[model samples]
Target chain A: MASLGSIATAPLRAEREGDKNAKSIVFLGLLWFAILFAVLALVVLLVTAFFDGRTRLDADLITQYSSTVFPERAGARAAILGSAMVIVTTAALAIPLGVAAGVYLEEFADPRRWYNKLIEVNLTNLAAVPAIVYGMLTAGVALSIGLPRRVVLAGAIALALLVLPVIIITTREAMRSVPQEIRQGSLALGATPLQTVWRQTLPSAIPGIATGSILALSRALGEAAPLLLLGGLVFVTYDPNGLMSGFTTSYRSRSSTGRHSHSWRFSRSHRQPLSCFWSCCCS
Target chain B: MECDGVDVYYGDFKAVCDVSLGFGYNEITALIGPSGCGKSTLLRSLNRMNDLIPEARVEGAVTFHGQSIYAKDVDPIEVRRRIGMVFQKPNPFPKSIYDNVAYGPRVTGMKAADMDDLVEEALTRSALWDEVKDKLKQSAYGLSGGQQQRLCIARTIAVRPEVILMDEPCSALDPIATSRIEDLMAELRDDYSIIIVTHNMQQAARVADRTAFFTALADETTGDRTGLLVEYDLTNKIFSSPADERTEKYITGRFG
Candidate 1:
């Protein structure tokens, strides 16, 4: 009976192989098309940017201040410096605070407690809130406190608020990736929870935390809506000297019209390096 | 270190019930049981290592050196400092072998001049010095599994604990490494009190001075499993002539 069954199924097995081959070939073709489609879009975007603004790429475009009448002589010096200061300030404010909050939530806080649960739920929701809303919060606070409007301080604070949740979420994930065994080993050695976190947990999590912080900072650098709401959308000829000084980021400075177009190209130039760094961080 | 009528609870569920055991100075006591028998839980309670879990609470008393470790004024850090642990799987920090051994003393605030001596002494005591002496600066990950386990032992010893709790220390090792660790246990027993939890009955017979057998009791109504100590006696007596029928059955491999 076994020999008869094998003889009967041999032809059927060969026919099924033909069907499987056709199915796999179709899937392979579709996958190839999808990959090509993504690559093509990216290639087109890069080529267009290069072709449209190739001539504007020069020393003057980065060194000299923006010009109203001489569009050709315009530069993004102030916007570049302003964006750098704001991002650096944002990173400084967000990273430590975010990582600390993450450690508390992941390692210390009891998940069953109502208050800790509330914080967890709220943080998840806040991460989804639009960047424009964070701008409004900064503007409202600046106005209520009677602080000078549209300074680098206000913008950086707004950006920090926007990216804080991202950093915290990523940091929590990074901390979670560390095995429970490592924590147990450290604590069994008689180290306090704080000591375990500082010595064992945090060091292992640095790579993930650095990557998250960089990605969040890159997103902060590209945000124009929040800065606009913070009243930093106006043009500034001189670079920001300090955190409290008037400043204009690249995104805030980009607009339509002749000199604005030249300045917008300069803004794109500023964005390029940020995005490049972001990709490297991801890899 | 000793526990009296200790009941461990994970949140609302009882994990281990009415466990009473004691460890004398310069002696080795082994806790033996099948899987999920809460032997590890009882072992962890000795040093209050269970306190790391937010909801894991222990009823009754676990005293170290005549002081209740769970007393309101006593710190768990101090308890752990006096009673270190070596885990089932060797966990060497992703650091140099030298640093791995040095970590415990450094954390406990040993003087810099004394740290070098402490690290070297620990490595030598754990019997890993000869194999790794020349590669002290190399990463701990470079060591074999057995070597790493010994390194962990050295790291624990560097803290100078009065007692060391080892939870299935040789379960992850080969027969040769297991034998090496068994020998190390015998040697270390002359210095510090050791409490080991093992599934291997032969291992308990080999190294343990006192043996305690834990068995899981399944509640028919609730279907909840809770571990309880069945018998505790001298290792030779427990192996040769056990008092309890259940202990005999388990030892003879009739049933868990």
Candidate 2:
């Protein structure tokens, strides 16, 4: 009987010890997570401050464009122009197309349909694919069409393809967030389904779609790989005068509405057809 | 208003079956029933609100102003524009109080100069102008439940609809708010045909000119559940001494 008591007590003592150790481990894990987060945040802050604190940054960065090695000549003019061209073109191509596709999928397409499910799965997978793959595809297509391998148009197209999935996903989520009741309410008021979507549902989702487009544009702006593959010139001395020209001048001009309305005429003209194709093709 | 052999189906499940009722112009008609008894469904069918549900199928002839509403050429949008609805939950749009009242007018292309006068008239008629006159630009979502419901009523009135449908508009409001809405309904009955569905028998007794009692029936052959109107008559007659034993039992809380 004494031996049995000792056996049970021995296991109980081990369990108690184990519980104490487990608690300590959890406490340590939480402490480590906090320390790691703080360190990462500090690193990001320091890097940003260091870049922003440079004395060389001035109006020259905005006005005199180029990346000359000489300190006096070095400016972000061409880089800014290139970035603007890419970003604007991306927005012109991506926003309408992405949003239309998203709306069709979320509002019109049946989720249970095999074709719709296939399209949805493909879009998700496309979002995860590397941007470089898109660049390669663009290059191949351009080459086949007897066009130059590395052109602004090619880069814009590549970037659009790369970010299209993301824009669609975000737009779908935004449209989905609108209450079903709101749609019903609008329809009940005798508004046509098209009118209900355009006036009620779409208006409510504008903020979300705008936010998504901005995020996609920001990602496209910072991307170096696809542009590098598309032969984005690192240095350009003059501003682009036409759709076929390389980025040469920054185009971030202020408008009356305080919104970034890009004046890329070529891209804007292409928007209607591209959006139509996007909705039809995707759905 | 008249419904001839109207049946409502949600996909294959029959929700309301074989209902025929007529509502007079400028009269308050109240539909009262237990939960899932198709009172709301029947009410929604009046304005074709059931069309919003993809699977909801309605089979019958509903005539408005001596014209069949379900005719092939009839535009549901126009019908809805003529027949306005106030929902059970008092859903005011997420806009300014003034905007909420002006939405219907704006959608129908009412002149901008006329909107201010229209908004004020609707709000006054709904009895909300006195409380919200100082804050016309404020968000409609900030209003109390009662106030929001009144705003919805004001919104419906702005469209100048001929008929107004209320699906338990006061179900979510307090008694004071309910009384306010009831008063507004009485006022509105002079200008518009009002059809209300309510679970509260007392509310129907207080405001309705005519009361309809609907009950669910289980079909043995088809094994389907459907709603059918049990009895409808003058509100006082139905409340005080109903001819049907079931109506008396239901009103007296003896059984549903």
Candidate 3:
């Protein structure tokens, strides 16, 4: 027992000495500095935004609509409503389509076939394409499809397209993580391929799928180029009544605020917009 | 169920060759062999479960109730519903005990009113009801290894199958749990035909009414190995007086 303790402790001492190397110490310090910089930046930004926008961050911002004539009194009611509408529509369009495509590829499609390989390669390429390019594509599509100009529906469609590849990739990875034995067990119980995927595989993968979908939605929510090209107007004073109504998103306001901050030299009027933008992006 | 001149292959390589075996209703048949001797492959072939593997192919015929199961017009799904399986490791779905048992009946569209009674009966028949009766809503993963294996058995029986194929069902279990499973198999033999694959000869002797001994034959030139059935007989005869030298050598501990 004494010799066993020495044997274990000898390795642990050697490990401790080895972990204190100059190269690793330097690398760890650099990593810690990077993390500290990020947290410090976030803390400074939130504190500044809180102090600048506290007066305007009240119930009126949620209930009142935008007004260009009285820019000081204008709130984000229309922008918030439009953001909610686009997000709901984007989720409604993207989730089922993305999950179904993932299931088909992972559970049914034969990877050996050139058709499947082609589709898979294209999906990866699509994910790498910039959001601005998707905005351009959605613009062309909206025109050809005869959609009315500056509608919330067009913005939602553009955002859905932007995030579809992300959702599909994550969902496929989630499904792939399920053990093959679980599938075999379900198949042995007389389940059809469709039934096995729907009942057994999907339920087991819900947690992973849910996590991936939230990440994808966050990515979609941050996109401004797609909304801009899809004809999201800048000065819509009224809240959107339906999907086809003219709208402006929080992203639209944030992007406009970023431009205004550079030109206005940090004026009092720009403070509220900057703070609202930060809160919208972070929250 | 019966296999007639059945040959199983993975792409071009033969796994099990020319196996002609018949199973009587209400009897337990144990397939015993060394590892890689294709006992599990043969069991999967009986219910057309090998169809799930893209590379696996079967020649000749496997029949159920005198109907060829692999016939082009027949659905493999229908065959599996009547012939369920249990794996080496207990694989209860990550679900409540009640849902695990109800899965088969629900997928196959049994009446909702009869599901509770059916689930209870299956749990009782597998001898798991006494231990898990109160925690029916708990996840099957919370059960011990032995209990999980028994839960799998209950799930298999819940489909109202005429045949049950078990591949090393008790290999991961303790001796006491093994005996419990053996006793349950003996009781179940009165209701359903069972085919079990085991590396343990003692287990075969304990629970099986009939035993089939499979051995691997190696070709020296190509270094190819194929599993072939050597002898099948009553359990007592196979253990006490094996006809083949290989079977005798294996049982008497001369060689694998």
* Candidate closest to the true structure, highest TM-score: 1
Give the lDDT of residue B57 in candidate 2: 88
Per-prediction TM-score, please?
0.91, 0.82, 0.90
Candidate 3, position A166, lDDT? 87
Tens-digit lDDT track for model 2 on B16-64? Answer: 9899999988999999988888999888888888876778889988999
| DockQ, every prediction | 0.68, 0.32, 0.77
Tens-digit lDDT track for model 3 on A1-283? 4675555443434546576889999999999999999999788766765665576677766777665455455667777788888888889998989998988999999988999999999999988899878778877877897877578778878888888998899889999999888888888888888889989999888898888888888888777778777768866778789988998885223234445421111234344675556544543
iRMSD, all candidates: 0.9, 1.7, 0.7
- lDDT accuracy of residue B237 in candidate 2: 97
Q: Write the per-residue lDDT of candidate 1 for residues A1-283, one digit (tens) a residue.
A: 5776567444533444653687799998999999999998678657756775788778987897776666566788888899899899998899899999999999998898999999999999999999999999999988998997689889989999999999999999999999888888788777888888999999999999999999999999988889888988467899799989989886223334434332353235434664344334432
Instruction: List fnat per candidate, in order.
Output: 0.64, 0.34, 0.70
lDDT of 3 by residue, B117-184 (tens): 99999999999999999999999999999999999999999998999999999999999999999999
lDDT of all predictions, in order shown? 0.87, 0.81, 0.85
Model 2 Cα RMSD, 1 decimal: 11.3
Off by over 4 Å in 1: A1-20, A251-263, A266-283
Give lDDT: candidate 2, residue A214: 88
DockQ of 1: 0.68
